[model samples]
Target: MEVELEIKGKKLVLQTGTLAKQTNGSVLVKYGDTYVLCTVVAEKIPKEGLDFVPLTIDYQEKAYSAGKIPGGFFKREGKPTDREILVSRLIDRPIRPLFPEGFNYETQGIASVLSYGDENIADILSIIGISAALTISDIPFNGPVGAVRVGRINEEFILNPDNEESEKSSLNLVVAGTEEAVTMVEGGAAECSEEILVEALKFAHTHIKGIIALQKKLGSIAGKPKREFKVEHGNLKDAIFNIISGKIENALFLQKKLERQQALEALFNECIQNLNTADKDISLEIANAFDKVVKKIMRETIIRKGVRVDGRKPDEIRPITCMIGILPRVHGSALFTRGETQALVATTLGTSEDEQKIDSLEGEIYKTFMLHYNFLPFSVGEVKPLRAPGRREIGHGYLAERALQFVIPSKDEFPYTIRVVSDILESNGSSSMATVCGASLSLMDAGVPIKAHVAGVAMGLIKEDDKVVILTDIIGMEDHYGDMDFKVAGTEKGITAFQMDVKIPGIDYEIFKKALDQARQARLFILKKMYETISQPKELSSYAPRIYKIQVKPEKIRDIIGIGGRVIKGIIEETGVKIDIEDKEGIVRIASSNEASALRAIEIIKGITQEVELGRIYMGKVSRIVDFGAFVEIMPGIEGLLHISQIADKRIQKVSEVLKVGDQIPVKVIEIDDLGRPRLSRKEALKEIEGKNISTK
Candidate 1:
């Protein structure tokens, strides 16, 4: 079966029943020659004792899809790349919420790129394929979600813009939704206004509806009967509520996260003891009942009295403190604390050699600015084995990096490579946003010359029937209970990065607009607090290596490099400096902690690449004597021919009669031949010196 639609003059094609027939559900999505094959499988029975579904989305990009072989030793794709992991999260976030509550089946979805045309990206197509596959299969799903990437290029919205178009665009907004409302939003912009973001959302939804209609058409003919699944609701709610009742609400009102958590744990213990049941099932029932009551009371209190768990208003932010230069040895360091969350961020400056190289399907690219986020087990007060960064850490780091990327200086403006590391010292909620704040401060502290101060805030939503409450600067508990987690980051001018994921089916336009506005206000407030500590970039740290830049003729690049880089390496060794030379533009960067060493390296490079000008005088050393002329070394690598006729006013018998090797004498560059060789005259240089001396007398 096939369903096709033309979006923004590009064809979107969906086909099924011809491949992966053995799987429970499978679909192949094609957009502008890029194809994604998505398949989903779920166990018939739920995992025993599992309260949540164990679903994993693996989105892999096969090298063969792009007509290239894998570069590594194994010659095949190994672990998931960061791009794959992020795209997998994109597909999982929207679809996971559509599954019925209490469906704890262990499910897995795999989206493989079958073809990479480079015209259309496979990310959005993967989401569409997964949604279509689940809709047609026996698996229970309440979705035919549509996704579109919206790009704005001159205030006009473009749907699913190609890679080239995306570069020219200011906004790269990916919106995913069911037919009725948007479910997920993830992408970044270049400091665009909030209203502009809203318009983009509305534009994306229009195209999204078309995608949903196409999915529905495919499902109508090939949809299978949903499997029989029963959601068991506990009847112990009333029975357990009598035991905890008024105590749960008071426990929730505790000011601190630790205190609130301890109070809840104590109440759960009391409730379990009051039941006094040896039966394990009764204890589990009591636990579930206690959770439901806590959730209900928290929501009710917030809606009725406009009070939060921490005794703040719905829009109130937590107390924040920003400190800089905390670490003496590092290039730049800052400690940003907001309520219980804190991030210790440090920045380091390096030369061009420190740039990161990324090999992807498109091509190889180098990144001069990098941000790394580390979340230790101790930060959350948990004990877990230390290992490589998990998916969550990478995702958080990428978001914070994107948020600050807009403000980072260009390579031409600031030649040094910049790296920012954010360590989560303490985490209750919004550690990622705290990282953004700390990173911005540290960049300024390192004298990065970023455009503006960037700040981030995590906004949340709690909806009960018609009552929707938008939360600003939410803590961990509110985030866990809320229906939406919307993170927005930017400068005071506009937004730079944004991501939103909702547990509910979807959110309408009104909620989206309100969430963005609230997030913007929160971000500005945080920026104001950050500026109180440090406003602009300061002087470069004493520990940082000073870089001196100079450009030479492109042809002279090879001369400076010499055979096997011997010439440049010699300069670095003699002066104790680091040198980077660009071949095309001949831009040489000399970096050294010692100012004298850097200047000396620059002098050596200039001498090696300098050209001799006609009619110019230079102090020359006679390097070799020949019958016709003598070779004089004017610069380090440049030599000029001083013929015997031009050596003196009258002709001499032999070149050695007037001058010999290793003689230092002033000479004039009389002429330069066609082959770029300079002819030198010692008589003319001596006459000019004599005339100047006579005038002074």
Candidate 2:
């Protein structure tokens, strides 16, 4: 059946029973020519010990939809690319939060690209489809959430523009929300001010609200009765309230930051000890509620008194300190701390072989730069079970990576594989921004030669009435109390990346612009502090490997490679250097630990390679002397036939009189055959000898 719905001043046509009918809930959604097939399937049982809803969203792309073939070996669909993963995450963020708590069902949401008009993004549509699917499914959700991609083009806001149009815009902001509030946001901007980001969110909300209304209308026609699960509450609630509320009032009054945190922790520990005698099952619930109450109190303090827990002005930033090249053995390292948030970032440079190979629907590709983020429990003054990086870690790492990617030098310009790791030594809020600051410093420390210094700052906003206060370099408490968390990063000339997540329905354009301008001021201050430590990239470390380039004739590429790569392998083994050779078009790169090894590899390459000569003499070895000609070895693995007729000034009857096997002789090149075979003459050598003899006499 085809369902046509009008959403937020746009038309949406969702067609089912036409494509992918096998899935439980599948719909081909069309907003103009861009189309996406959204399907939802639910498992029969819940995942064991899972406290939250296990909703997995997979967004995929096919090359055929884009009218392109997959590149490289194994040219077929593969694992999701980073871009796809990010899109999936965007769809998951807003909808996941809207689901009813304790709904621990295993569910999957897949959005496969059927066609893209090259304009409308599938991200927004996918969010709508997820809501639509759940509306008709047997799952319990307080959704009908709407999503929009907002862009600022020509100093004006645009909602859902084409790809080409978005390229010219300064901002690419994705906002997702319910009718009451925004739940998620992801975007990158062109050095836009905080006010602009906030305004973009407001513009997005207006359109998103319309979409949500359309979803509700559709649900009214096709929605199912939602199942309910009891949220267990016990006597621990009163105990949690008494323990947290008592300390929060005093903790909020403390002016010193560290002292206040200590007091809070002490209170929390005392509460935990009191709960030790109570039921173990309700202990965790009590702790979670206690944390929520603390967050609420913090928010109320900022809203009512206009004072933060740290006792700073509304727009004040925390103390910032930056240090570069902290690790002597590393290629580059930096320690960056803003208030309590600290990150130890390090960079390592390698050859092209070290690049990460990615598999995706687009095709196989190699990424020359990578960023990894790690967060330890100790950073937050907590003791918990240690495990590998989860989805949150991956997502944070990717955000920092994208923010810095705009300024990284291209592979051809800087032929080194770069890997950056950000370790959180302390956490308050905006650790991702801390990673960005640390990465920029570390790159400079490693001598990466970046175009300009990049810095990131997180801005917080508390809105009351028409008045709004924008806080710079927001801490953990401010982030919780604030209505908006706007993060912006860039160099002095322009912006690189920005993300905004709002707790309220949205703010207006004026507020968004104010926030951006305030963020810029904070960002510049942070950049200045960073420059005091390291102004420019240093010379590459001496311990780093050396890379050399060499070019060879295209035809001789196979000869250099030999059978099954034997020739290249032999060179590597002999010189102790890594050689990467391209047979087609002939380009070879040599990377080694020292200059001598690199030069040795080059020597071996030159030995097996052939060079064309117009006229040159060679000291040759006679391999065989026949009646008609003498075969002589000129260069390594190269032989030429010297005719007996041309052996001397006077004709000789037999070749044996002049030359013998295993004899050293001088030969001159007479001509080269069509096949590039050399033709030599002993007669030419004899004439040269006679001339020397006459000169001596």
Off by over 4 Å in 2: 4-12, 15-85, 96-124, 134-143, 148-184, 189-217, 224-247, 253-259, 265-293, 304-306, 465-467, 606-610, 618-627, 630-639, 645-668, 682-697
Model 1: lDDT of residue 395: 91
Task: Report model 1's TM-score to 2 decimal places.
Answer: 0.97
Scored by lDDT, model 2 comes in at 0.78
Model 2, position 179: C-alpha lDDT score = 80
> For residues 109-209, could you state the per-residue lDDT of candidate 1 as single tens digits?
99999899866569999999999999999988989889988898888988788889998999988899998888899989999898998888888888899
What digit string (tens of lDDT, one per residue) describes model 2 on residues 1-697? Answer: 5567664355687666566655556667788767888888877665543446888999888777766677668887776666777788878877776677667778899998877665557777888887777766667777778888888888999888777778787787888888866666787766665556666777888888877777676666656576555665556657767866666789765765577778877777777787766445445655666666676677667777777877777778888989988899999999999888999999999998898987543346789989999998888888989887766787788888878887799876777899999999999888999999999999999999887788988888877776677788888777765777777888876677877776565565666677778878888888899888899899998777778877888777776778898888888888889887777758788898689999998877876675635356677889987878888887755789898787777877888887789887778787899988889877776677677652210
User: What are the Cα lDDT values of the candidates?
Assistant: 0.89, 0.78
How many angstroms is residue 488 displaced in model 1 relative to the true structure, after the best TM-score fit? 1.1
Q: Lowest lDDT 10-mer window, candidate 1?
A: 688-697
